[model samples]
Target: MTEVDLHMHTTASDGMNRPSENVRMALEAGLSAIAITDHDTVAGYVEAAQAGQTLGITVVPGVEISTVAEGQDIHILGYYIDVNDERLLERLRQLRSTRENRNAMLLERLRELGLDITIEEVIEQAGKSASGDETIGRPHIASVLVSKGYVASVHEAFDRYLGKGGAAYVNPPRVSPFEAVDWIHEAGGAAVVAHPGLYQADELVERIVRHGADGIEAFHSDHTPEDESRYAEMAARLQVLVTAGSDFHGERNGHELHAPIGSRRIGAHVLEQLKARAK
Candidate 1:
């Protein structure tokens, strides 16, 4: 009955917790294993792995790469990555550069719309580090809006301002999910399409799985029972692995986003399924 939540975030990306704190939280929740799937960076993995070693909780080296296709934001999860692959580092650096530009554009758009906000505010809210390279994303912006009462919740903030088609939403050029799949493989990792239900595009999800993705996240904190059943069936038909994750981004204003760490999990066996399927 051992379980693993293959997707979680930390301060390395947009999540509120630090890498060691995430591991300690996972241990408290009694998870047998977990992954630190930060966006566009593996900066948190080493800390998480060291903490996990001390706590006897298995840590999977992972990252959540930001990709775009068909004018929509998509995430591809990489598991068991080398964490020091030069190719992965070069590509992620490029993606983070694009993100920096887009964040500026988005903030300007919000300001034009008369919302008083700054990238510094967003970075401070994201828990800035000495390196100052933490990945600042829409979720961090959404939190600032929530704190300022411009939005009621992060979900609403996205719906009204930060998400796709929201007033200040700006998508810059980035890698496609297809390219990300190969990036994961080249980094000696397995790529899983992260949370297909959010996309509302099953055809594209199917294409990616068919296009050599190791799996799809069939179970997620945001997914309904139907989403789980549908994607699970799709994976079965396609004869690929099925994975689950909480997509936890830590709590804000006493609200735990995408649920808590162990809210959505699958048996530990799927990690094996992933390793076997990857290139």
Candidate 2:
């Protein structure tokens, strides 16, 4: 089947690869299409789209908007987005500001936990991969932890300090999933609930669908077979689109942070299904 991985990241957010590099990687992976779903930014998608055009691969314009509901972090993925939409850009700027506040609070908490880390170190680590408008985030913090020998790897860093419920984990105020769905709709994109299995809140996921999410990411790199089955069932029951993605965040010290591009894929025609909703 012609394949597409609908969720991915690049250095424009937290992934280690550059945006254009991701497009090249997609072509190498034999993918017919992929989305540049960087956290809260479309610059990666814009860059990848250009590169994909040159490389003859389909790059879907997308962004991953972080949201919160029921004290859990949820991400709403937007496909076929208007990258230049002024309102979307302004909202993203606000979200980035909120992320800054979150970072400060997280840093203070980590310091209190006796870690010898700083914002400069995080910025330096992020700059190693980032180029233009990249959003520095917890992954960079994990990189700092690994570099300082505080953790052996990014996954270990998250397991010990950075992930939800870890000693240093902090969640600041952020927008709701409902609001994110509205934002995607206003920007003329199909909104998909990202990695619902990670959230572990069936009621909250159901509520987001009821609130008008256009799709659910049923297949993801981190999801178990049970998770995929459950969400696919839910999507079918709700009459919403079921999507698949690798959630590809490049590598750290040669180990994949998430999954390789095309690791979890769906038919390329699913891209048209999403675009149809977007239209």
Candidate 3:
């Protein structure tokens, strides 16, 4: 079992579990530490960190930022971030605004495609998934599609409508990798390119490293054995830190609760190095 899971989510973003529940799940899974890296927001970290203090589990303050490179979306994970940084908060507020605007457009597109879902329906579904505190995301809309029987599952909804190339999809404004790394550093955090394999942009890694990324997510739920080896070699050759995580999202988006939380083993020392970079 993994003693440390550096990446996870909570109701503050798209994950099903609330911050406290995610903390309890991490403890129940026997993790010594975990990071709540919610998408585009740090709203959950305070609650998770507080719960960790009470339960004796370490909670690392983090966020998963969505950035675009070469017309494709990639994620950057920031560990030990100063969640209260004004500049960071400003950027996040803009991102949330972009998402909200995109959601409205997506709803219009879905309506044109003859789906019976509405924004009110999506909000209701998102509330059902969380404590009505989540950043409204495409997954919430997809869940509404599923509940309304317009789609068989969230995956189907995405495959047919919500995914990047789907008819209902709309591109949102995104910062470049360079900007993302700079933002994380400005917020007093270590920036790591998340799930590099998923990007299929091998050439992009060296470019990100050039932008001063502090680490590589060598082990992730989506990484293949080959990806692990390649990223390990890249991290070694570049002399960058290596980190691992389950990318646990509770039961949201077809993710199982326990399979990932305790699956990938991330050494405590990796986090130590990340914290050092944060300082």
Q: Give one digit per residue, the lDDT tens place, for model 3 in 1-279.
A: 336888888878778888999889888888889989888899999999899999998999999988887878888999989999999988987777777788899999999999977778887777744233347888788888877789887778888999877889887768888898999999999999998988889889778987799999899888899999999999999989888888887675463532457577686777779988874
List TM-score per model, in order.
Answer: 0.96, 0.97, 0.93
Report lDDT per candidate: 0.89, 0.89, 0.83
Model 2: lDDT equals 0.89
RMSD of 1: 1.4
Highest TM-score model number: 2
Output the lDDT of residue 203, model 3.
88
Sort order, TM-score high to low? 2, 1, 3
Check candidate 1 and list the clashing pairs.
none
Measured by TM-score, how close is model 1 to the native structure?
A: 0.96
Range of the 10 consecutive residues with the lowest summed lDDT in candidate 3: 125-134
